[model samples]
Target chain A: MDYYDIVMDSCSFPSGFEHALGFKRVFVSGRDFEPANTDKGEDAKGRLAIGHSSKNLLHAARRFAVAVVPMNLGLDRAFIETLRENSTILIIPLSVTYGASSDFALSTNMHLASKMLAYANKRKVRVGFATMARSFEHMESYMQLIELAKLIGASEDEARQGISLAGDLFGK
Target chain B: MKTKFRYVLVRSTTSLGTIDEHEFSKGLMHYIGATNYFKANPRVVKNIDGNSFIMKVSLSGYSALIVALALMKHVSGKECGFFTIYASGTLKALGKHIGTPGTETHSKSSNDVDNFANNNNI
Candidate 1:
């Protein structure tokens, strides 16, 4: 069985052991979002229930040997340029929401974001999806985001290969 | 020696109209848990000419700071995103690309800006 790496706010950590078991990796980072297990400081599994930085996430990605991690990819020319230059850290960028109906909004729409990711993949960058899910009920959004990445431009074989790579890196 | 920070120029894409610099700056500080940093240190949000703003942060924390800003989905029910425009070790270097307030001139096209940004970062 394979599990996904889920990034969420600290306060929304799984309600119980069963809920926690559903994910392979969980990263809870947000100042306004507090941790669920306030008393223990760490969860039952010894994972800290606190906020952290992108550097922490990067370290996690490195430790798991995952080629790509889902994160907020900035649209700024310099930031994007820096990203293209690094090439080592692959990221699946989050969609930029610009109000409900702006050209910026349209370009950052989920469909278009996936298309952009597809184009990036063609350039040999190991892109991954980091769709934010507020709660377990948001699984639908997560699935849709992944499906968007998998279905666009990627061949069936390529999709399967990517999955295999993810499993090899993250699976227990 | 005076402390130096990694200067970043950020463009706000989601605000419906012009951004309220004071409120947005406060929100940004809270979002990044820099409230104490703000209280202790001087405010770094300089050259708040329009939608774009320049900020100075600890050099080591630059990427993490950008990530924190990038993770924000909504603020007070308004959907928004922070796009990084330029980052440099010095405000002077960043000002070269973005220009100083009241003397601003954007010389490059959007596509060219992207290319320039991409080529120079690594």
Candidate 2:
């Protein structure tokens, strides 16, 4: 019954994250956008990293527990292999939902997410859903977040597990 | 003929005030599209507070409407978050959900629907 959320450190929720939102733990990170190729951070225990390139994606898979797919990802066999090897949790963040400025942007985000999700399904990659909120408006209720995972092509069961699975790796 | 509908409980940011219906429809149209908007045709049934409200929409358009509600990030130029708390088939049930713990308030026009239809309006 205890749900968890992963958000950017910049996100300011109301005083009680648990009482107000129902999330038992909320993981925070300022350097989630750190490139997968860099050694900028010493630890990747529960940190998120951007998989901007195929080369860096394979490398980032090993370095970060969660590789956030911020852009329209074009996955290859080798990338999937590397991600599976590292047991990396591919994250489909809510920033993609809130950041879409227009219908075009929304469709773009959904299309990319659908493709990523399909790959996750075919390859059995552990995926997570997070708010990654940049502002108060960027956050959503747990149900809404799960609905969003469905919006981007996750089934009812897949969406629920994806959200909780991401939390399992980071949340205490 | 009776028309089936769903009541949605929504919670927004504390700063958000009573939402103008037209502006709300316009913001939601961008996400659900004009056709789905007509299918959903959501109307504010009650304002629980500055941060929360109850809405009613046709049952057929429930899914698209929920997605639109979640996608709505700002309203009337103020940054806000709209969270759909609970959705139920009856206003009395929705009322109990928000903990008024009082008399059951059911709009006969919506419940029995009498002669009303989903497409009767312009």
Candidate 2 local lDDT, residue B26: 89
Kindly give the stretch of ten consecutive residues in candidate 1 chain B with the minimal lDDT sum.
Answer: B101-110
Measured by lDDT, the strongest candidate is 2
In candidate 2, stretches whose alpha carbon ends up further than 4 angstroms from where it belongs are: A17-22, A30-46, A50-54, A64-77, B14-19, B96-122
What docking grade does candidate 2 earn? acceptable
**Please, what are the lDDT tens digits per residue for candidate 1 over residues A1-172?**
3334444562253233212223344444354223223232232122222112333333333333224332333222332233355443344433322112453553456454555455556555555444344443222122223333453445545443433333343334
Check candidate 2 and list the clashing pairs. Answer: none
lDDT of 1 by residue, B10-34 (tens): 6554432454556665656654567
CA lDDT, every model vs. true structure: 0.43, 0.66
| Ten-residue stretch with the least lDDT total in model 2 chain A | A32-41
In model 2 chain B, where is the ten-residue run with the lowest total lDDT? B100-109
Score every model by TM-score. Answer: 0.35, 0.79
